[model samples]
Structure formats: structure tokens, C-alpha cells
Target: MTRSNTARRTVAALLTAGVSAVLMTAAPAHADSNDSCHPSGAMPRVGVFGNEFAPAPSDPLVRAQGWVDAGLTCSPMGSFGGYRTDAGGYAAMAWRLTESMEPSELLSTGSVTPLAGRDDLAPGDGLLNPAGFGHAVVFDHWADDAHTSYLGYEFTAAGVQHRTIPYPYFAGQGDFRPVRAAR
Candidate 1:
């Protein structure tokens, strides 16, 4: 059979079993530490609130594209953002879908759809910054049982970095929404 067909069948079988079982437990076996995710000699600067590897690009679409490309190149899981090159991840994909429509027509469409709630979040989900100007990252999973905190993988100005942010933190930062990848 073709590789694509084989891949689809494998995915179908896994989904038939349960996708959460796969996402919840598929993180790299390595411990959660800066050393584990980031390469040597590339220590992200410690910050008062959040770590800043570098200044993110002013344009949200540019930033999103950079994040997905960087993740594809270096994520230990083999696919960092779980995004394909053609679609250009969430922001770019969303932009593509909404471009033809009038600004006020307001149709939000893309390779992803918003999650109903945080309870529905899973690893590999796309986290959007917000409606107009926004950024995106790959959800890594909650870091605590209370579900108050979660881990995320995003490409920063410095490079690809794993981020530990609280659940409410995203909202406070105007990134209150999370979306699941369509594929």
C-alpha cells in the first residue's frame, strides 16, 4: 500500500483505540528540564514573568510560520507543531481561509478549530493568541493534576523553546483560546 494510505490506516486504528491515550503519554521519555528540551549553549534568558528567548516577530503570521518550521526541524517528537508545510500552521491557515471574505463577514476557518474548553485540550493541539493579532504554539499537556498549569512548545525569537504557563495565564495574556488541529 502507499505510505499515505498506511499512515491513514494507522491513524484510524489509533483513533479507534483512543487519541488521548496517544497524546497524553507520547512525550519524550526525558525529564522536563531546560536541558532536556533546548540544545546546549542556547539558554533562554530568565525573565520576571515569562522567558524570552528573543523578541518575537511583530507580524503574527510570520511568527506562526517560524514556529512551525522550527518545530518541524528540531522537536524531539519528530514533528514539533504537528503542522504540515502546505497549511502553514494555525494562524497562516486561518488567514488563508478568511482572506477572501470581508473583514466584517468574520468567518474563522483553518487547519484547526477552537476547543470548547480547557478540559478538551490535548497534546499537539494548537493554542492561538487571539482573534485579530495573534500567535500560536503546540500544546504539550498539563504539568499538574489540578490542570492549572500546562506545558507548550513555541518558537520564540531566540529559537524553539518549551514554555510552562498557567491555564489562566494565556487568557490574561490575551491568548485565551486553544484549538485542535483539523487533521
Candidate 2:
């Protein structure tokens, strides 16, 4: 299989592996340090009071695409109980689907595998910002054959967006790194 397909498989596993843990024990909500960053509201058909485990749709990609396809606005950007409980920021559509992953813990103590570069990105793989409080997104697919542009899904101040990210953005900027849930 291609690296992209391998990435997708890893992400699928990453996204599903934690559901078992979620069933075993309900993770406590440890609010983020900055209360000012807490969620201000909830997204439609998503979560309650910005609770990631609060019966929202479980698939990150599905949730993101649904919001974009329906043009639904996202909840305001806010930090919540830990990264897993975060339901209003860039990680909103994904947190519950994977283990709690703080930016600082990525690829080390966190439950993900890193890639060499963007070319390995696949649908469902995470485009994570290694710089603590930056952007997080899911790679959808390459938008162009030259690999200059790609489709990505994420939640932003405007709401859930599935748009083309072209050169000079993360693809060209190299600020974000490609990652997948560890096998």
C-alpha cells in the first residue's frame, strides 16, 4: 500500500482504539489552565457545553466534513478541560476519537506517529502544530497533481471548514507536521 493509505489505516486505528478506553472509564475533565480559553458555546449536532465525550459524532473527518458541507458554524475557540475534553477549538472534531494529546506530548508520550513530511499525509491523518497552541487539522486529499494544493478539514472561528490549502500555507510553510495515531 502507498504511504498515504498506510497513514489512513494508522489514523483509523488511532481514531477507534480509544473508544474502548472511553467505555472502560469516563475520563475526568481537567479544565485547561486558561479559563479565558474555555469554550464559549457548543456546535450544532456536536457536543454539549463543549464536552468532547458528550455523545457527539465520533468520526473526526465526518464531523468536519458535515460541518463544512452544511455550512454550520463552529463553537468559539476555547480551551476546555484537557485536550480530550476540548470541543471548541481546532481539535474539536477529533479529540474524543483519539487519546488525549497535548501539543507538548506529541510523538513522544502522546499516542501518534510522525511522518517525514507532508507528502505522506492521508485522509484522517492529523496536521498537527508542534508549537503548543497552534492549528490542528485533518488532511482530506491532495487538491492538485503537482501536490501544490490539498484539501483539509478543521474547525476555526468561522466554523468547520473543508477547503483547499495551497502552497505558502502549511504545505509550503512546514510549520505543521504530519502524524497518525500510533498502531
In model 2, the runs with Cα more than 4 Å from the true position are: 1-59, 69-92, 95-109, 167-174
Which residues of candidate 1, in runs, are more than 4 Å off?
Answer: 1-107, 168-171
Error of 1 at 35 (Å): 25
For residues 38-96, what per-residue lDDT tens digits would candidate 1 score against the true structure? Answer: 33332221221211322254333355446545443332222222322211223333233
> Best by TM-score, which number?
2
* TM-score against truth, every candidate: 0.42, 0.52
lDDT score at residue 154, model 1, on the 0-100 scale: 54
**Candidate 1 CA-lDDT value:** 0.46
Residue 12, candidate 1: alpha-carbon lDDT: 93
Instruction: Put down candidate 2 lDDT per residue, 1-183, tens digits, no spaces.
Output: 999999999998987888866753452222122321324332222223444452356565765565556544433333333223232244534544333334435556555678777778777777666544445666778888887877876554444556776631443323666777553
Deviation of model 1 at 107, angstroms: 7.6
